[model samples]
Target: MVGRVLHIFNIFFFLISVFLGSQVQGRSLSVKKPDPDNAAATARWLVAQNSWGVLNTISSDLGGAPFGNVVSFSDGKPGKGKGIPYFYLTTLDPSARYGLKDPRASLTVSEYPLGTCGKIDPENPTCAKLTLTGKFKLVDPKSKEAEFAKTALFSKHSEMKDWPKSHNFQIFKLEIENIFLIDWFGGPKPITSDEYLHPKM
Candidate 1:
């Protein structure tokens, strides 16, 4: 009876160890967010890590009201982000149409999707959010930049490559002029387009 009880205790201990190990592994899989004080790094990190965000544009059909649409974007290949958001868009989508009418737009991304914000409400200031406001321009399909953009977009979103070619998906990029970042409790961080695009090494 003594040996049997010891064997049962060992099994229970082994199970607990496996459970704890899995929990640690799960947490490790999440990307580590940058320091809140580093606004440029934080903003770039948000853009690089997130696969999609809400792109807001001035609606041409809605009497010039602001309209936000969920869309997929890529800054660069994984870990090679240039800090500029590139998108695969088609005029069939209202966002592409609105952007063509009025190039002014903003792309907003949240750190919540990265799974680094543990137990924090998405709206909570500490959750970290970034918005890049600027002119939305379409890249000429034949240009070298467009080639890079296509690679960036297709790499991040594989389905984009197999998307219906009839839809005429064109490459678009935001000419970031201003940045709004909220990573901590005080208020939105004051980061300029230049600062974000060219961070100090």
Candidate 2:
């Protein structure tokens, strides 16, 4: 009788342990796959939503590389097609001038704070931002590319016409190759092109 009782007890404990293990495994899977989150699409979404972003370019001068500057962008207009961004900049614009001199450049658009103003935990920093790495090439102002850029600019910022114009003004299209979205500090595992466009998770 005692042997039978112990056998039943062993089976019950085994089932209970298995149930707990399964729950843990399920939670692990959920964490690995953050819901409704496609990093590439989300990156494009974040950039589309914001009108302004800081652009980083490589300088040809003897000084240094990775020069950062604030710039305005417009996406998806009558002339400018989707999946492309247009910017209006002058030769006086250090980044633009340097980019013209050296076509190799990487643009970073982020939720640049006017000044950090918030109350949050020190260890867990929370912010919504996206960073894009790609090359920037200047386009002729009178060319077909320029027409698209102008239309896109006017659509996004109607007041752009009021600003002083320059012949050196050029449009740069970022050939995005990588995107980084950060919800916390130290950077999350970047969603690659394949994973983002067609997530297997």
Candidate 3:
């Protein structure tokens, strides 16, 4: 009977841990969410808080269909985000190959990953979502910006530093042309690329 009770206690503790861990936020949000009314801030915060997102590209393999792949990215170190997501991709992947063929892509991120959504469904408007549509251009590996991007990516994803060099990975950034953000009720928020790069807040 004592052994059975001990086993039950261990199972109970494991279940408690699982429940708590599920509430943990994605990456290092370190900062609280901005006001829902602050479109730029909310969008930037969503980008900075999450480490992985769906990167959409025009896929040749799909006979010119929009292909979305879940990819890891970093805008900057933790809270010091620049709102320009940098991805370390290799030509071995279809997204990278398509980007090389045609430099058009978009990345989408959601607030649900940050655990701030509470119990609400991910599709709810109040949950917040950001989509950045832009040209996907490759960064010159020897440029200063590449160094900054490497630091940003490695800071968030340490394993990237040790990724197989044979993979021929390269850095790429999105040149924001349009922003679609929905944080609350009503239509999508109107935020220009300039406002996103240089928010008053």
Candidate 4:
């Protein structure tokens, strides 16, 4: 009879522990959610309607920098494919070469609606944007991944198909280590991977 009572108590304690654990997890998710009109959601939304954005790279010394290069981007997913989050670039492009020399780079995408100031200001609610900071590397041309990158790029930027020796194209995968999301007039906040995936916006 003592053994039976002990077993029952063990089962009861296990059930209570699971219930408490689930509650904690739920609270954690809720707390991490950002403002619905902030930077986190903006990153995901940027990829939704457009396949292009500005790729920014800063030298290790932070001496040279440029903005808005009109580069094509992929969500690392092949339309309806898994979301791996990558970008296709050409080594032939001066920007790509700059990036190769300085692997420390960031990609900034806008979330402004059609028209209105794309600039960020406290009053501008439409000025939501996400800047991803990470290390970038050139994709091996002979690899199968390059084949998919080419197909995806050509599909989005048909003009690329007409360029001669486009085989020199390189895929740059920005292994995102951090995301800085900004809202008009709001200080930028560092977001976690979970927050990046489910941004409020």
- TM-score against truth, every candidate: 0.84, 0.63, 0.88, 0.61
Candidate 2 is scored at a TM of: 0.63
Measured with C-alpha atoms, the lDDT of residue 40 in candidate 4 is 55
Candidate 2 segments exceeding 4 Å error: 1-36, 77-81, 111-126, 140-144, 184-186, 192-201
Q: Top TM-score: which candidate number?
A: 3
Residues 81-168, model 1: lDDT tens digits: 8999999999999999999989999999998876778899999999999999999999999999999999989888888999999999
lDDT of each residue in 1-201, candidate 2, tens digit only: 999999999999998876785454321111221322455554554455556677878767747667878888876552223545678877876877877776665555543331121454322334456666667777666798778778877777667777776455567766667766765556664867555444343
Please give the range of 10 consecutive residues that has the lowest summed lDDT in model 2: 26-35
Give me the runs in candidate 3 sitting further than 4 Å from their true place: 1-26
183 in model 1: Cα distance from truth in Å? 0.2
Count: clashes, candidate 4: 1
Clashing pairs in 3: none
Candidate with best lDDT? 3
Q: How many angstroms is residue 181 displaced in model 4 relative to the true structure, after the best TM-score fit?
A: 1.4
Tens-digit lDDT track of model 3 for 8-49 = 999999987766764453355457889989999999999988
Taking the candidates one at a time, how many backbone clashes does each contain?
Answer: 0, 0, 0, 1
Give the Å shift of residue 37 in candidate 2.
Answer: 1.8
Candidate order by decreasing lDDT: 3, 1, 2, 4
What TM-score should be assigned to candidate 1? 0.84
Residue 12 miss distance in model 3 (angstroms): 20
Q: Report every candidate's CA lDDT.
A: 0.88, 0.61, 0.90, 0.59
Residue 199, model 3: Cα distance from true site in angstroms: 1.3
Q: Pick the winner on lDDT between candidates 2 and 4.
A: 2
What's the distance in Å from true for residue 96, model 1?
0.7
Pairing residues by index, what is the TM-score of model 3? 0.88
